[model samples]
Target: MVFLDEPTTGLDPDARQEFWKLVSSLKQQGCSVLLTTHYMDEAQRLCDRLLLLLQGQVIDQGTPEELIERTVGDEVVEIAGIDELQLQGLTRQADTWYRPFGDGYVVALPTQRSLLWEQLGSLQPQRLTRRRANLEDVFLHLTGKVLQ
Candidate 1:
């Protein structure tokens, strides 16, 4: 077993890739690795299972895909630069779940995505983006905070 805590912090991108290759090789050799990292991308790529911590307490644990599916759903929709009234109106929509993010909201889209787009269009947000939900989204949904 090998233990690493934030092992790749501050490394250049090329170096980071090299480090990941090393870790992958170790796993391929059947070595068990325990790694700690603030980089969600790294965690998602390298780990088979993850333990999420908040305020030094374990808040959740699962495979990366399981965590994202359980917390943020299939898609993420972000609407930014909207006023308070628009935010209020959106919150009232049934079957939609959202949380306040910087200058806007992060919405976890339901299985029915078409209705969500229609509702968002009615609001005419200054900026809107839709993307597949990812580990970062899960982290934000679970902790209400962004990792620096």
Candidate 2:
């Protein structure tokens, strides 16, 4: 068994990749690895199961896919460059889960892109993007805070 806490925190990208390879090899050899990391991508790629902690409390635990599906669904729509009034109006109008992101909000959708488009078309957001929900989205949704 191996315990690693933020093992790749400051390593260069190449070094991180090498460490991931080593961890994968250990798993293949039937070694138990316990790893803690703030990098959601690393956790998603290297772990079969995950325990999410916030403020020293266990908030949720599951496989990466399971956690994402349960918390934020499969798709996220980002609407940016809107003012506070517009944001509030959109929040009230859209009947979905949303959270504040960079300069706008990220809305979680359950594969219904048309609904969002129809509503957001007239708003003329500076940037609009749709993407598959990931572990970071799950973390944001669960904790209501972005990981630093």
Candidate 3:
């Protein structure tokens, strides 16, 4: 049995890819694999079944598609800058939250940041953060960003 609790937290894409292949092989051999992850892409591509845990309790559970449809059925946008100065003014009208990134910000939005995008419509950002259902979105929703 192999238990993975966020095994790819800091692993690069190549490493995560290799780790996934190994886990997939174990599942092929009929090994009972139990795991916990905030990464939706990993669970979607790897697990036969997934259980989402929060504060030591099981909330709603389902496949990535199911969970995403139920919670976040909106387009996502990601914007990165030296700081969230533009993010602060542009995001005041929509639902948004700041997820800390080293020396900057990684924002996740359940709604589109049209206002913000228009403001920076010309100034291309260093990075763009979308509401795509990855590990971060799953954990954000689970942790209750909007619910907060």
Candidate 4:
């Protein structure tokens, strides 16, 4: 077994890529790796499983999809507009999982993008964006700490 601490730290993409390839090779050779990293993307890309921790305590553990389903649901909507009234109006129709995002708000949904789109359309938000709630969001929501 081998333990690596931020092995990819300060490395360029090419270096990180090569490093992961080496790690994978080690795994295939029956070596076990225990890696700790702050980059959620790196963890998601390389780890077969993850344990989420906070303040020296293990809070959660699971595979990526399992973590995804646990921290965030199906999808999230990001709305940017000129006024808080517009955000409020949209959020009212956006259901319970809505949250503020700078000059905007994000709403998490279990399913049906069309419903969210329709609600947003009715509000005529200046800029609307839609995407899945990825590891970044999961980390922030669960930890209340954004990773830059």
The estimated TM-scores of all candidates read: 0.87, 0.88, 0.57, 0.77
TM-score of 1: 0.87
Q: Candidate 1 lDDT, tens digit per residue, 22-120?
A: 999999999999999999999999999999999999989999999988887788888887675665556556455677877888877776544767677
* lDDT for 36 (candidate 4): 96
lDDT at 50 for candidate 4?
Answer: 90
- lDDT of model number 1: 0.83
For residues 1-148, could you state the per-residue lDDT of candidate 4 as single tens digits?
9999988899999999999899989888999989999999888877889998889888788987888887777677777774666555554565435556777766666554446567676677788887887776677667763211
RMSD of each: 3.3, 3.1, 4.5, 3.8
lDDT of 3 by residue, 1-148 (tens): 8777778899999999999999989999999888777676788788765667778787767776676656554444555664455566555555555544455454545454346545544457776655554544655656754421
- Candidate with maximal TM-score: 2
> Model 4, which residues run further than 4 Å from truth?
82-94, 98-105, 112-114, 145-148
Candidate 4 overall lDDT versus native: 0.74
Model 3, which residues run further than 4 Å from truth?
Answer: 1-19, 26-32, 37-41, 73-75, 82-86, 96-98, 109-116, 120-126, 129-131, 144-148
On a 0 to 1 TM-score scale, where does candidate 4 land against the true structure? 0.77
Candidate 1 ranges with C-alpha deviation above 4 Å: 145-148
Ranking by lDDT: 2, 1, 4, 3
Lowest lDDT 10-residue stretch of candidate 1: 87-96
Pairs that collide, model 4:
none
lDDT of 2 at 47: 100
